[model samples]
Target: MKNSKKLFRIMTMCLMIVMMMSVTVFAEGEATEYVPKLYSTAWALVPPVVAITLALITKEVYSSLFVGIAVGGIFYGGGNFERTITHVLNDGLIGVLSDPYNVGILIFLVILGAMVSLMNRAGGSAAFGRWAGQHIKTRVGAQITTIILGCLIFIDDYFNCLTVGSVMRPITDKHNVSRAKLAYLIDSTAAPICIIAPISSWAAAVTGFVPGEDGLSVFVQAIPFNFYALFTILMMLGLVLLKVDYGPMKLHEDNAKKGDIFTTGARPYAYNEDDGKKENTKGHVLDLLIPIFSLIVFCVIGMIYTGGFFSGESIVTAFSNADASVGLALGSFFALVVTILLYVLRKALTFKECMDCIPEGFKSMVPAIMILTFAWALKAMTDSLGAAPFVEGIMKGNAEALMNFLPAVIFLVGCFLAFATGTSWGTFGILIPIVVGVFSNDHQMMIIAISACMAGAVCGDHCSPISDTTIMASAGSQSDHVNHVSTQIPYAATVAVISCITYIIAGFTKSAAISLGFGLIAVLGTLAFIRSREKANGTYIE
Candidate 1:
């Protein structure tokens, strides 16, 4: 397709998503206390439906998000009247920005943008690609690389999806690996890793949405109960060892083996296509490694500082109390400064050239910033309508009946919501109120429930055709969307099953370590069995 058509479609989609989100936000804020229960639930979830509709129609992420935001705003604006426009501005836009949680996410994203820019300018991404390319020779190796990289970059899912996808795409492609497979790998690892990782931005975002609990401390406690994440990671590891080909995933592998390749979406920066294009133009590989190392080192130190690590506080306590945005921003700034120095010293370009990369880096993040802003608007709208109270009431009641199966049930529900809405954060936000209210007294059960919520959302979002991570993963791998979704479901489900079992055991034992350890053993045993069977058949995909 022509660039103009693509751009037009993209803009149209964004407008739709924006409109839906705006309606939702505005409607909730202006909703009357006497509003009907059914109407309120419809109002609360309208953005997601609109988002999916736009995505399916436009086949674009930004467009879908924009439309979702707009629908949310319209709902909040009350029947899409002109008079409600003022409310959207005052209540939706202002409210979203003023939110402490939203503000933190914005700051974190902006800084992440800067850091990514520095990484690109410093050649860190390319360096990582070069390093990964040398070792990942087989399909199993590719899957493992994607999983490990996803786990390593637990600071944020957005960062993980984009960066890992960018770095690994070339290697995966070279091995005749399907773009769909690569997308699966990226999506699978993205949220699952963040949901489990204590210091990540997902934790920060989820913590912010939770009420009546110290956002940070609650997250720390919640980590132990996050059985979905623990199990998902194990599943990834199991897939690597066993190489089990099942369901749609098996067909995808078969297609890939036959060299069937398909790709869609806008060609954003043309960054993923050719690895060697800038190799000689860029400085030595260390130019990349140094900036990345510095970025990681400083980010950790920064998180520590915000948490007041040396002030005689516990590590978990410090993390919970830390100013995450400031920490992430400062760390990114530090990396940027270091990147410039490296560029100058290496004579890769003049000072002017070095300075030019900053804006260029930020330019790449415009899409992310826009989508995030719209998402925030949707959140504000839903909250204003008292969506949380209703959801909490329902989930809490349901939990009473299924407390014994809370882990598995929450996992399933989380996945369903995320798949339908195309957002793990939204799923997490909606579920938190329910989980918190239901398991407030039972700390053990609460942990299990919350973990399942986070994990289940990630798992479903990882493979869902509509999910942004799924889209980005496909875009990064330049793969077909249906192909990716079809192939990944089985592997994800396998993990889901094991993860559910682990959560049940954890609830009884109230021990995270034992549950995780025993769960890993079970996953490995499952993998070994699959491997032995595959060897016997000699036709994994078939």
Candidate 2:
């Protein structure tokens, strides 16, 4: 596989170089603004598509992302060698890395890692696990508690992903749940719950993008028809309640039951010994709860702070304008300080012991950090090539002909765009306006169409390996990133397929009651078939 990827890179790079040298200049023409032939065309989406496809196939995100970035540079640079190099370096990598928001997220990631390390060193995680093991006797209870915590943290997906994962990982681990399964749970709850929640950042983003309409009102109406999100919630409960497993997730879970939680030997993360040492036996349930609660409180305050809550905006308006990256970084930073101080005051860990966790936490987060940086850089390449405009054009161009099938079509488009770009917010931001323009407010399918758009974005982001929430989920669960992505994709894809069908039903019926009822039936029916098949094949886990 490595050799093939290397060969592919060599050939593609050579082809790009040859193309660069072979192009002819129009010396006869007067000076004009330079424009790449691929600009705003369907080809604009090719780079991200290539990246996403290769990442899934190769199981190597870094090289896949770089290849995609190079492809985008080729498209944008128009076969100019010097320009391609300059564009890839200056406009792509540096541009994204230098963005204040991106930097803030990286900082937050590192800080969150440090705090998690400190908590471990203080024995908070171990203590919580011991407590949960006694009270949460069944695996179903452990999974349900994780889901509930994830739902409660709906203010932001990133927050939900990390907080739920950190708090629940110990409990899940004790019950022999695979890290991959934990990641799937964290990820499924993160975006799916947030996208549907009325008071979430996702809600704020959706509202801000819809022009000339009351965004919140539309969001509220569309909630019932958000088949993907709602069905996903149902799917998770069914998985836990029925105690069934299928797909790649089943393999991991089966292995976990044998005591190999990871199912693979690839060691991406190095555990901190500070947490396991004999020096710290003073950990308590409050040691974990206080810091986690404090982090949540400070993070919320930080978000409102950024939105100028003190400066005069209403709560909704403030949320709409809040800088999540900045707020999270700020909130986590302060939260870390409070945790360290609390540990020191409680004599759980010395001041120096808490301070020592800073570097340890940073080390743990390095994998996620690298993946996020590359993903951001790749997104930048796509942006520079005008992928957003290209996507918007596709949505607008086919609207008239696909009117009856608009909801399904929009859902598919939303899935593809969000999957390629690894961002649900950006996908919806691009499509929501086009959907609005195509269907008037009075149109029967208008709200349904909008719901399809939101559902698809969340579905795509839920599966995309490069998504920040996905990355956060892996970090939170302390799972191998690729393992989490690979195992979760099948599960996410199942929900997406059912969701697409539900959208078709919705398009025709234009009624949430009929659409939602059929959607629920379809999901439950599919799961029953899977379970029966597993039992028939003698492969059922139980």
Candidate 3:
């Protein structure tokens, strides 16, 4: 409550100043209108910026996202108090909640939460952790195992975040790895891995936006120039292997080794592993592995099913056409049913216990669900204001002007847009079309710029609190959402800055060999530099 009041006052003061500037400009009749004007101006970008800044400062997410939605409402309402309230309620909150696709995602999150709850209650998670501990040995091994598992689940970012976080969290925590660190690992792998994997949902999203062309072909080609995604992977390996920890991450990692997984006082998630369950002693690692394996297989089938694989489409075509949210929700629902039946048959969980987990899982997912709903609504607000078009106009306006440096510029634009909008798919959807126009999808620059777009969008989404993947990462690790966002930024930003430079190099070289080489060296070099400096100063947490 105190944090809410403090954030409210700050936002109100800023809004009042902005409102005054609008009024003075209106009187002159020379400035662009703010009241009903959105979708092609700088103002479309304000809501997320304000919200992200406040959340970072206040360490409160719900209020910060609401503030962002409110800003969007005010702009959409055009200075009418009553209209603002109506817009915020009708078009912002209810609008997103009522949408079928959004509702499907909510269902998936809740169901997955329940499944996880069931696993924990049945002692499957503990069993898996115990099993992992024997093989994993040290903290470094635990972190590397997390990375390896994350990289393997490259089908979908959403699936990756939730699944990896759920599976690896216990193991990582057992090894004294912090929840924040676990979240960063999960978040880093999701989009970064998805974007580079041609078989992933991210690749499909990229291809969907590029009509009348071999979208898949270009997507594959863009992989090498995808400096952000590739270099992010490089950075993660470097961080894990070299024992690199800096900034807020260092504090969390240090605390983790000292037995505090959360450096902060708040724990937003309620899932507990210590609940009394006779199954805990009886459950073996198979209890955990079987259910997880089923979920993945079912989810993949669900995607292809929606994409019409059964109806005649090829695997790649099916993947490209898959409705990920709907498919995932559908798949997870079936998976839940199957998992329940398995537990019941195995006597790992009583039917009543399985029934009990349904509510427990929903309860566990509430924090993530709430944040996701608000984040989606905020994105809806941005859309109402035409944020995508605003970004589109800018890309189109400067495409020719920034020719030689287009990849670098495009990468920066994608990063900022994705960060502001909190959706990589949307970021590239907007810019990709305009990019095709700029290069006519003709030159080598086309692939380079496209790669930059994909890379930067992932980087921004990785850092954004409002990003769905980021939200899932927080939920998966059961870390405080604010903590995950606050700690992930520096790490993601380090890679982003380096990727931007790589794009600049790619834009000119048009040679993956040279640019990619430069990126790898830069990333490894940066890690080496940090490791050396830490060693010299004896500031290394170890």
Best-fitting candidate, scored by lDDT = 3
> Which stretches in model 2 have alpha-carbon errors above 4 Å?
1-34, 272-275, 441-444
Model 2, residue 452: what's the lDDT?
89
Worst 10 residues of 2 by lDDT: 21-30
List per-prediction Cα lDDT, in the order shown.
0.65, 0.84, 0.86
TM-score of 2: 0.94
Error of 2 at 36 (Å): 2.4
For each candidate in turn, the TM-score is 0.74, 0.94, 0.94
Q: What would the per-residue lDDT of candidate 2 be over residues 1-542, giving only the tens digit for each residue?
A: 78767766774687566656735522223388666778888777788787777777766777777888888888887766666777789988898889999899889888888888888889898888888988999778988999889889998988888788878987888888889999989998999998889877789889988888899998988999898899989999999888887888999989988888888875477464335563355689888999999999989888888989989998877887788989899999999989998999999999988888899889988888888888887788778778899888777878989987889999988888888888998988898888888887455578888898999899888888778888889888888888888898887888889889888887887888888888889889989999999899898876
lDDT of 3 by residue, 1-542 (tens): 58766767877788766555444332224466444665568998899998898888878899889989889877876765666667789988899899988898899899998888888878888888888978999999998999999999999998999999989987898889999999999998899999999887888899999866799999998888888888888888899989998889999998999999998988987445444353466687877888899889989999999899999999999999999988899889898998899899998889998999899888888998999999998998898888887778777777888987988888888889889889999998898888877887466888888888898899889989999999999999999999999889998989888888888887777899998888888889999999999999998876
TM match of model 1 to true structure: 0.74
List the lowest-lDDT window of 10 residues for candidate 3: 21-30
Candidate 1: residue 373 lDDT (0-100): 62
Which run of 10 residues does model 1 get worst, by summed lDDT? 272-281
Please give the ranking of all candidate structures by lDDT, highest first, separated by commas. Answer: 3, 2, 1
